[model samples]
Target: MYEKYDVVIIGAGAAGMMSAIECGKRGRKTLLIDHAKKIGEKIRISGGGRCNFTNLNTSPIKYISKNPSFIISALNQYNQEDFIDLVKKYKIKYHEKKLGQLFCDNSAQEIIDMLLNECKLANVVLKIDTKVIEVSYKDKIFITRDNSKTYLSSSLIVATGGLSVPKIGASKFGYDLAKQFNLNVIDTVPALVPLTFNEKILNKCKLLAGVSANAIISLKKTLFEEGMLFTHRGLSGPSILQISSYWKEGESLNINLCPEKNIFNFLLDKRNTSPKQNINSIINSFLAKRLANIICEENQIAGNIGGLSNKNIKKLSDSINNWIVEPIGTEGYKTAEVTLGGVNTDELSSKTMMCKKHPGLFFIGEVVDITGHLGGYNFQWAWSSGFVAGQHA
Candidate 1:
């Protein structure tokens, strides 16, 4: 006989685990399954292993979705404070990093353990390393198959996340499952990933590798003021990664290398006070030594600041203030922190995260079209959406 459950949740990641706990808490027999041997691998490695679990400043505005207002209901229903309360209940020591990002004081495993313990207390059944072979719906019941067993449930929740960080088992299974159910799946792309430059640009900036500076990276109207890092492949840092979500192929990024000060004014002041100082030397005080030299050489400003003509000074200032770079592409899903698109939000109810046409089917987490900015925003989405679904699933 097939094992029966009130709800069957696929993927034991953040969303699935949270959903299972809630469902089980409601006195529903819940079964949470994953193909991986270990659960919460992404959470285990997130935030340099400390896990930026949630953002204090979480709002619907921070998310990107086809339906921009679709996330408002879930977010309002389960805000960051609600999750913070849960963390406090677990006695997980956490600290607030910059920009309202909250990270655990210890390893991310604390988060995984907390979720696992919640599931245990809620009496949620968990199955790891169990590959789902097939799924079918009949007589208002969903039937799912693993390699050696068949399971039946009244409700099915698909928390299988997006196709990012494939090494940790990210897959297109969520998108495929959405299609199988005739739900619209948006075209997916890598987000919160590094941008790669062309050979020409890379060659010019290659010497600046490992250099980091306070920068403002802008794509169209959106701007992110944070630290930008120069890498061998291209640029990767809080600012660049934040902007990458809004960037598209064939678009150029406007980078303000020194957002904290006006380069033109600084250089002009330096020209008066330190006439004999090399132009690059003045720039080096603000930027990295290697990047300063590269920018000076690229703009053909070789002499001291006092010897530079007005035109040369303007050119140098422009190079520093409004540097434009066109990236060839991104590092792709191999290293992307999240996938930008997924099951279309239009097909699911924002309040419950359940499919409009299919009563018992739900989609949550990164599998949904709503993608958050870098930091703890994505985790908040997972919690909000998962909680909403679990309440009704």
Candidate 2:
């Protein structure tokens, strides 16, 4: 026998749960299904377990998509403020971290509990450990089958997220499904990941590992001013992660190691006032001691400032300000926070998150082409897109 529902939502992530809750609240027989034993595994692991749920600064501009304006309607319909209000209604204690990111003060489980409670109140059915093997539409009904049973629904919502963390069960199921339905899917790549340097660059700065600094990292028009950390493999920090989204293979990153100070003026003053001091010692006062020594060695500006000429000083100052390094590639999807591209947004309705060519079909969250920057913007996209789909799906 086959179970019938008004709406069948694939995946039990944030978007799936929200859509199920909304559909159920409308008195629809909604079924939320997931292959994993535990729901919201990503949510449980996000934000270091505290879960950065939403960003107060969320806007369509924060997202990147082939159709840049596609996010405007959904975001405007259900914005960050609305999600914050929902958090408040659940009495989930949260704190605003820097950059307007809202995180739970207790545990991310608080968020999971809140969503589960909403689903319960709305009478949404949840089925975990259920792998959907097949889906077909006929006679205005969508049919899906698992190992043990078959199910049917009038509406089907695909919230099966992108392939970022495969350890957590991320897959290409959503993209494959879109292609199966004749929908266009953008070429996918890892985003918000760490950058790995080639052997040449890594060998030069291997000893500088564990050094972190407040710097400005840029690739073309995209620039991020945040903390940059040096790892044994390469660079992995907020600043690098942000720029990685904008970076391409063979592109060199222009990093300002000392963005707060004018290195030229600072070094010139040191050369005048403390001529007897070693150049490395003077640089130590400005940057990390180890990094300063490495920089001095790499530039070969040995001996005391008194012995160094104006030309060497200028070279060292320029090196500090405009440190250019070309990254070989990124850490890939293994440690990536999100996938860069997904289902082409041009095929879907912005206001409803429904497929324009097919009625009763919707795609939301990370599965869509829209990808937000680090912080809480991605979660806000999930809420906005899921909310919009639930209204019409």
TM-score of 1: 0.98
Question: Residue by residue across 1-393, what tens digits does model 1's lDDT show?
Answer: 699999999999999999999999999999999998899999999999999999999998898988889989998899999999999999999999999999999989999999999999999999999989788899999999999999999999999998898888787888898999999999999999999988877876567778898899998899999999987787889999999899998999999998888888888888899999988778888888898888888887787889988788888888889999998889999989999989999899988999998999999999999999998999999989989999999
- RMSD of each candidate? 1.1, 1.2
Stretches off by above 4 angstroms in model 2 are: none
TM-score of each: 0.98, 0.97
Q: For residues 1-393, what per-residue lDDT tens digits would candidate 2 score against the true structure?
A: 999999999999999998998898999999999998899998999999999999989987788889888999988899989999999999999999989989999999999999999999999999999988989999999998989988899999999998999988788888999999999999998999999998877875577788999999988888999999988888888999999988999899999999989888887888789889988888999899998888898788888897877888888987889899999999999999999889999899998999999999999999999999999989889988988888987
Error of 2 at 114 (Å): 0.7
Clashing pairs in 1: none
Cα lDDT of candidate 2 equals: 0.91
| Model 1 regions more than 4 Å off | none
Clashing pairs in 2: none
